[model samples]
Target chain A: MTSTAAHSPFPSGRAVPTPVTGGRGGLLASVVGVAVGSVFFLFPIYWMLVTSVKPPSEWLTSPPVFIPDRLYFQNYTDALFNWGGLKGLVDSGVVAVSATAIGMVLGTFAAYSLARFRIGGTNLSFFILSLLFMPPVAIGIPMFLFWSALGLVDTYIALIVQYLTFTIPFIAWVMKGFFEDLPVDLEESALVNGASRLRAFVDIVLPNVRPALVATALLAFIFNWNEFSIAVLLSRGRVTTLPFILPTMMESHYVLWGDIAAMAAVGALPVVIIAFLLQRYLVRGLSFGAIRSE
Target chain B: MMATRRRPSRWSGGRRFALLTVAPATIILIVLSVFPLLYSLRLSFTDQQLLSLVPPRFVGLANYAQLLQDNLFWSSLGVAAAFALSVVTVQLGVGLALALALYRLPRYQQFIATLLLIPSILSSSVASFQWRSLFDYSSGPLNYFLGLLHLPLLSWTADPRLALPSLLLVDFWQWTPFVTLLLLAGLHALPASVFEAARVDGSSSWQILRYQTLPLLRRVIAITVILRLIGAFKVFDIIYVLTAGGPGSATESLAFYNYVQGFRYFSVGYSAAMSYVSVIIVIVLARVILRYMERPVGRPAADVPVAEAAV
Candidate 1:
């Protein structure tokens, strides 16, 4: 019912036709506006890079340098290996991989079933997507005790399972939408040709939706990779994820921005790159099914 | 397929497999996701502490009563509301503006879009700690930058008044793109004909935006607002890392308050009750958003004018 509104913003980026009397002024204003906007948008990332490269001397200097004199590569090198680097990396990697694996292998089938099968109602998709709307703190404490009772606290399994509360519902809901947008005739033809349903799904339908599946897995991986609170709640120092570890570095008086920046930059690199590369699907993967209003 | 199968008394392979395969994940969700939730519901009524094995004595209305009378509870609610409203509104405004600006910039749109998506991908804690140096009072970049403009030095975390807004600024910086992305999608999905028709008929940009784009985007805006609001309401990780609801609860969102009450103070029942209250607010907010999106905006009534129809 809502689609009939008539005016559009003319796609707000339209180059305003300059007036002759104020011609240069209008052009100059827009140019300045663009530069200001670019700075505002980019400054934080720029700061992140700057801090990572700054020598310990310039890390917290007065009038922080927009550019550093010497490239401080050691900051990154130190942050990683300082806190039992390989071990921290392994722990974080284990938790993230485990969570993403669980999300993918199990979430894929449920998502496929939800998309293809008419389960309970036409609006089941909305119901599923709405699960992503839940705040994690909603269940964090309860799950903490639950996992503790299972003697799973501070273990990899506890954190991995907790990640499911987020990744499963999100992956399922998003992949279901991606799957629905796929033409069903390819799978139907396979069914008609006497291949079993599972085979057809694996060989035919899956290959087609592989981009989205990869995207979902990667997104799920990133979510787990970056998650801190649950890892903190369940795993104090025992199973520290990268995010959990980074914050503890600030507790000391000589807060090393050189190392923190290096770690932050390095840590953010993989997911940030993935997010950029697969955003064609990952952005869609985020609330594509979620925005269905029913 | 069910109809086509002979001996239909037996379940078809697809149906059987789907059921069998789906059940494990469903069961896990029930056990891990739903059961703990239900468990928490039960615990909210009890006098149970973490270590206690003795069955929780049913405390009935006491937990709820305590939460009602709790000063911290009220303050927390206020904090949460302020954070949610301020942060979400700023982000929404900034995001909408950015999206509009970038929408017509065909050449730079892709680069800007990628940059915009960074916060969504970066863990908030990572963003928080990285930003900690930026907000440092004495020698930080923020003050240094302000020093350049000869502006008064601002204490971001140290000053009680500024702490909340400081955190909000962080949230706005990080999440505006999310709002932009959602609104951008809505912008993309809009039909071109309506805007073109208005343009052809000599409508000005301001009138067209007011009369046209706003109405068409109402549902998307509502959904984005709701999602972002709920998210802001639950703002925890970043704030926890940077401020920890610092300078005397200035940045204490409801979720953080609940965390403190339960974990720090060991007031489990009171915290549980607080959680229940917050959950109700979130559910209502979400439902309102959901309901708002579904309501008829442009479905023409007999009396409404074309220009004002979306309103």
Candidate 2:
């Protein structure tokens, strides 16, 4: 019956009661459960890291080397310089950053409206939710034809614009939830002082929700960085994103396993770092802000 | 309901401001969704060929007619449905159990939770690559471990019988943590007084879990299921990486088949029609789920008003 849990921004925040006193057996079961889960989860990432640093001789060998004796940078060199990893990294970064920037601006603006004015009510919100369910193929197919027609194929604009389809809705929805939970008094006071609504939103309301904004933006960035289907469909040779090109490396006849691992390691690095940084917001971000963690 | 409440100009300038702010994103979404759909619908009825010298000709429902008879279409639909169903069910069950176990832990809960998130954060391509090495036919660590135990070696992705299951295993490895994370948050957020009252009243642990925990966690469970099912239905990246829907179309999901039809063959009309059919299926399924999500789940004291206004 202690009240020492962390403070939460949620309106429903409460001091979590102590965990059920399940005694020694329960603690033992809990530790065992986590150990089992951790192996299933972390071992693959370990394999990826080990594979990236493995020499060519070790990569395809039977009884794959659990640990490489010495680190090899050749795979990393070939992946970055010879293959498209460097280009993929730059392209993916540009696209993800651009999309995240635009998405945050447009999505935040729309979310504020939806939260405060309840614009179009649940109908608008539902429409946005439905977009998330629409298959990427459905979007990708037509986008391919349209972009090809406009001669915009393999362009950053094509990928960024197409990314907006998902990003806008996702960011808008998550931020809307955050905005809805905020007290209206600060913004109202600003408005009553003859400040414009836009000014009030920018100065008073936005600063209050800064943490949520940062969390939502970072998650949107990760989503865009990891996007594949749209990238593959919209770009081929010119604007090759990391996810799009990794498969080509795999499908090539030679199949440089070490190089592929190196590229994947490089590609997955940013998102993993961000995930650690956003550990507190991990559930909220992944769940599109439907579940907030204390 | 208080007459003393100073109603801000919610009806006058506020509505206009809302419309102005929301219009750009809303219009963009509508245009992007509707135009492609209508254009794709138009293309669906025509024999449009991207690589052909022959011009497109209107084919009416010929594409749809052919789709109904196409064995690949039927099989791919079956694969996608089964894959989605299996992954969602397994992830949910295992995730819920893991959440319950972690919930009882008195320490190190946050550290473990953070570590479990590593897989979900990685892109699908990287995850697939990791699994590919693990599932390598002759030299994989999996077979090596199996060999140490004197067990028979199994070809993971190459064998037709094991291909889908292998994909499922990779998916389970990558995403079970996500489901677990959501459910754990839900568990942590639950008001503990109810459980206290139940225990004080002499309720057994099993009875408390069945009557109290499950019902309270229903909304979070539903959200987790819906999100996972949606991702599962559109599963393409992992399939493309792991199997390329290979071993003679044994692993081709609907999205993969659509890719092959459109990109590989340049059969634009047929692909467009297939896309529409899949969209229809998703829309229908989403409509049902969204309706469920919108319904009032029990809200706490401060949540009720905000929930009503937001919904």
What is the C-alpha lDDT profile of model 1 across A1-294, one tens digit per residue?
Answer: 122211232423333321011134433554454456567656887888888888888877776777877787887778878854456678878989998998888888887776665342334434444455666666767887888778889999888887887788778766776676676678778878988888988999899988778878888888888888787778778888888888888888998887887778877888888877875564456553444211
The C-alpha interface RMSD of every prediction is 7.7, 5.0
Candidate 2 A-chain TM-score: 0.93
Model 1 chain A: worst 10 consecutive residues (lDDT sum): A14-23
lDDT (CA) for every model shown? 0.70, 0.82
Return the clash pairs for model 2, or none: none
The candidate maximizing DockQ is 2
Best by lDDT: 2
Model 1 residue A73 CA deviation in Å: 1.6
Candidate 2 lDDT, tens digit per residue, B1-311? 12112445532467778899999999999988889999989999999987999989999999999999999999999999989999999999999888877776535666678788888888887888888889987878999999999999998998999999999998898899999988887777666677778877887666777887777777778778888988899899889888989888999999999999998998999999999888887877677666544422111223212122222
What is the per-residue lDDT of model 1 for residues B74-126, given as tens digits with 9 covering 90 to 100?
A: 88789888988887778887777665655554355555677767877788877
